[model samples]
Target chain A: MSDRLSISVRDLFIDYEIFEDRRAAIRKRLVQHEGTGRRLVRALKGVSFDVFEGEAVGIIGSNGSGKSTLMAAIAGLLPLTSGDVLVSDEPKLLGVGATLMPAANGYTNIRIGLLALGVSSNEVDMMMPQIAEFTGLGEALDRPFKTYSSGMRARLHFAIATSVHPKILLIDEALAVGDQAFKKQSRGRIDSLLGEAGTLLFVSHSLEQVSSMCSRVLWVEQGRLRADGPSDRVIAKYEAFVG
Target chain B: MVTSPEPSSGLTSVSEALSTREYLTAMWKRREFTIEVPLEQLRSTHQTTLLGNVWHLGNPLLFVAVYYLIFGVIFEVNRGVDHFLLWLTMGIFAFQLTSKTVMGGANSITSNTGMIRAIKFPRALLPISVVISQLLSFGIEMGVLGAMAILAGVGVSRRWLLLPFVLIVHTALNLGGAFIAARLNDTFKDVQQIIPFIFRLLMYLSGVMFPLERLLSSLGEKSWLVPLAELNPLARIIDLYRWVFLGASLTGGHIAVTTAIPFLVLWFGFRFFKAAEWRYGRA
Candidate 1:
């Protein structure tokens, strides 16, 4: 599978079957599976793309333009109503609070977060200091993540997620949180990750970050690809589209 | 990386490193999370409220006492099962797990819109934590129930040793229910609104107030209701507590029936949560 394609998606479509309620759902079964009055909302329509071994891609779109939808479809979080996604790696999604249990301590959250990202116990132990040090929380590292401000929390999240070194990292608006200082620190670490042959699908609003971080950019509009090419041109088109 | 020189690493053996795949390999991994944040919040979430840690044991004890007063003294139910106080207390203690999970789990995901909108991890853990956190409370209530059973006049059976298994099943049932309800409530906010009504219906159907069989023989053969009635995982669990100290019998199809709901709830809940995991943070 690694011979050529790193991630392959073909004509993906995601549709939600909205039934009125459970009672209606049960009653619909009484009559027939059909005519349940279920309606389908197409979140992603015929989205097709590929990311090679070391490509960094940016997915840009207005709210509900299917940017997150496309990323999720590829991450296997949402099953496409009609399409296929094949990847050489198990993509780890690093969205804010995506899988992190907030009630746990930064220490325990790291363990759970690492596990969700597909990391093991021993490795997490080894990576612990590096993540803690990079997060720059110092004694705060020992505190509950909830105690830390949003920026502090994001720093820890960035450190732990990058520590595992995923082959393909799916980031959704995680960068938008945190303060300017946190951003600079996080960006430095993330830059180091991208330098090492990891393919990333970053979904964000900052045009500056998109142009700076991505090798290529894809703009989605109302569940369809509206623009695809170099980050500069795509961002420009996306800017106009958003306007 | 915003600056984007590209990352490159060599030399270190990543194989020896922790892989997320290995972590999620088991559906039920009992290890504590490896983080420094949630623990403080969880502790504070519990402690910041009045009564501190005492509430864990106090709340459930209070609930059991009320039921004991109502069932054992006020109305005076419980035909023949012996040690009516112990029986009523234990049964109420056990049944609350379902009611709590139903009410709590129904909105486990929906209620945490803040978390749902921001984070992503094993969604199952949300419901799992709700149930597990109550373990201490259950332990305290169990002690009170056991002592009461002995005082009320019933012989202890060696077979009463099987109580843990029932507790596990009860936990599983709660986990499963929460899992399914978590996902359903996400799509339908109204699910939370109707929880009290459905629970009331299930309350009578599952026999929380009295021995279900005594109410009517017509209920005996209703195979569909049998699972909820006899093996009522909750009732079976409480009865086991009673049987241990009071010599109650933990028999019948209730266990077998109740068992099925957990596994079904688990399977579907997992799939449903996974299906929506990606969409959660999006607008």
Candidate 2:
């Protein structure tokens, strides 16, 4: 990795105040004299890391261990309870269930998504064919997005997010639903992204995928950094703990 | 040549808010989103229906007819108004734009949680798109109102030229309400649930079905409330439209309040929405 700091996270803390159901919340306020029915969840606590340019750092953690939270924080999508995140440029985030206009067809969604990314209408028209080819859903592109399977939705979301060739890409389990063939295609896309000296922060439970694509890995456990080192070394420890 | 630059030399804080100038520039760059998405939404609004886009015109006509039957025939609330049907149509069409815009704005952020979490654009576009889409719908309804006015013998006068100006003022009012509602609903989803009731109450208070003068006269000794009702921005907006289409009388005071309040609300609403920019989609 180069010495150029692509992303710098310093002492970041994120707390989620999840509200209870309305009926339960009302009962708690009335019977137990609770002021509010919010339960605080410390998703990230004093977590800090610096990612260098051209580095593909993979984050591994158990479910609800804040791997996704850290990805989101790095993407600037989450509000930090404390601390700061500094970046060289805006990062593009791609996660499962990230959709636009569910009622619109896949083609329409792709066009809208590109436009939302600030691509002019002319550019979107020119790029439509290539994006459509990449999706590999020729006939299905006419169907509404809400009708797409999770794998299909993931493919469309990934294609649109990576369309503009983002300098910094933060991916959270978006590839988990793709089939073997799609995974291989996306791997080639990721390699081309890296070849351009792009920085990537990938969060996934697949140690194989992480080790294959990333040179370095971070292991987050229960809202704290458990390990940060080379991919093989960190993966070994993570596997020993969770395997 | 061998000197190394500091690692954090050119990095910018990711979570900091952009300056107003920068924010507006970014929004302008993405202006197509505010237009295209809403146009797509409007196109698909009746896609599933048998009658398809025809419902756009048909629905508003039916709405005016139903209101005329109830208030004009049954309730006799059309007493003081000449051309009761046209007046009622004007009021309903104008007021519906604001109500639909505000209600749509209330859910704009909440419903688009997926888009908000996925992409980084000016979040204001969501509510702005709602207003645009509602405005397009209002345009279709206005066409229906125009045809009805002609059939009802309301001639096109020079006052008709002011329709566009009045509509712009009304849009400013709708946009301001939209921004405020979007932020409020994002923070507390209960605001969406309560908005419809509030607008229903407003419809009555704004004299959407009857003449405001009659309501004031009916109020009799409640002289204090007369000025308050007269100052209701929605009433003034409807009055402005009525003046444009029906050649109804309008006061300078009404014109001044209608023009000023919308812009003021828009300024405040923009600030209010931007204040919570980072907090949206956190839930």
Candidate 3:
């Protein structure tokens, strides 16, 4: 990894307000004349880190431990309750559920996805063959997206998301789907991306996958960072704590 | 072999909003999304129906015919306008565009939570695309209206040339309403449930089935209601359409008001929507 900083997180905090049902909320306001039926969830609390250029950092945590939240914040998808996340370039987030249009066919979705990422229409046309080949969903590309199997959908989403080679890519459990062959293929793609000096922040539950793909790892517990160090060291610590 | 740009040396706060100039430039670059997605939606909208695309023409025709039957035959509410059916057709067609756009915009953000969370784009495009699709539907309806006017022996005139200008102003008004509704619905979720009733009430007040002049004259004692009905933007838009199609009377004051209000609403609505830009997909 280079000395140049690619991402800097300065005590980032994110709070999600979970509001009660509208009808219940209205009833409560009328009856209680006080409670708004809103609860604040502190998804991230004063977490700070700095990622250097060309670094592949994996974030690991138990369920609801803010791993996904941190990834989303770094991707600039979440609003900050306090503090800041600074990035050198716009980051693209690829999650298992990142969908474009469910009714549109896979080809149409691929075109719109690239267009949404600010790719020129002509470039989108040129990239069609490459994206189509990567999806490996030939002929099935004409079928509506809602009809795709979960693994098939993940393949298409990953192919479209990585089509433009974003300088900073944030992934959240997006590689867990698909078969062994597709998994190997996707791992190859990720390697090629990192080979180009791209920065990645991958959030996954698989310690083995994280240790294999990332040289550095961040362990988050609850809403705070528990550890940040070399992949093997952090993984060992996280494994012991979990056990 | 497109080489990716080197990572910038300097880091900027990710939560901060883009400058207006930067935002506009980014939006312009994605203009194809505003056009193509709506066209695709319009294409797929009728895919499940047996009649397919014919519903685009048939839907509006059936709508106007039903209203003509109720207001024209049963109630005799045409108010003695020349070519009463054509006048009612113009009013209903124009007003439906606004109502449909507003209704569509209400759910534009809420319904597309998946795309919003996955993609980072100007949320304004959601409401804007709804307006474009509604505008396309309006165009098809206007084509049918034109054929009806020709068959009914309404002579074409210079005033007909003003139809596009009037339609543009109407679109601006629809877009403004859409932006405001989109943001509100994103926050409350109840806005979508309430919008249809609101539009139904607006339909009667906007003179969709009857003439505004008739309402003004009938409300002689309640003279206060005159300017209110006359100033209703939807009423004015419908009146403008009537004036274009049937050579109906349109005053200079009405023209100025119709042209000015939409732009004002558009400016305010854009600001209102942009204020909550970062908060859209939190749910």
Name the best candidate (by DockQ).
Answer: 2
Off by over 4 Å in 3: A23-35, B1-9, B221-224, B251-253
| Residue range B1-283, candidate 3, lDDT tens digits | 1122333547888898987788878888988888888998988999999999999878878998899999999999866678889988898889889999998988889878888888888888889889989988888888888888889999777888999899889988999999999999988887888999988988877888886666667789468877777677888888788898988876333768767999999889989998898989676
- The digit string of per-residue lDDT tens for model 2 on A1-243 reads 677788888888999988768768778889999777778999998888888888999999999999888888888888888988888888999899888999999998998888878898899899999999998878999999999999999889889988999989998999999998789988889888888888999998888999999999999999999999999999999889986
Q: Backbone clashes per model, in order?
A: 51, 0, 0
> Which RMSD values do the candidates have, in order?
6.9, 2.7, 3.4
iRMS value of model 2?
A: 4.3
Q: Which residue runs does candidate 1 get wrong by more than 4 Å?
A: A1-4, A16-41, A96-99, A102-105, A120-126, A138-150, A177-180, A236-243, B1-45, B78-82, B111-131, B147-157, B168-187, B201-237, B249-283
Q: How high a TM-score does candidate 1 get?
A: 0.74
Model 3 C-alpha lDDT per residue in residues A88-195, reported as the tens digit of each score: 888999888877889999999998888888888899999999999999999999999999998998899889888888888898998877788788988888888877
TM-score of each: 0.74, 0.95, 0.95
What i-RMS does every model get? 9.3, 4.3, 6.5
Runs of candidate 2 with Cα error greater than 4 angstroms are: A21-37, B1-8, B221-224, B251-253
Candidate 1 per-residue lDDT, tens place, B32-103, comes to 432222233336556567777776667777876776677666777755756666656666677776777667
Provide the lDDT at A34 for model 3. 76
How accurately is candidate 2 docked according to DockQ? Answer: 0.55
lDDT for B198 in candidate 3 is 86
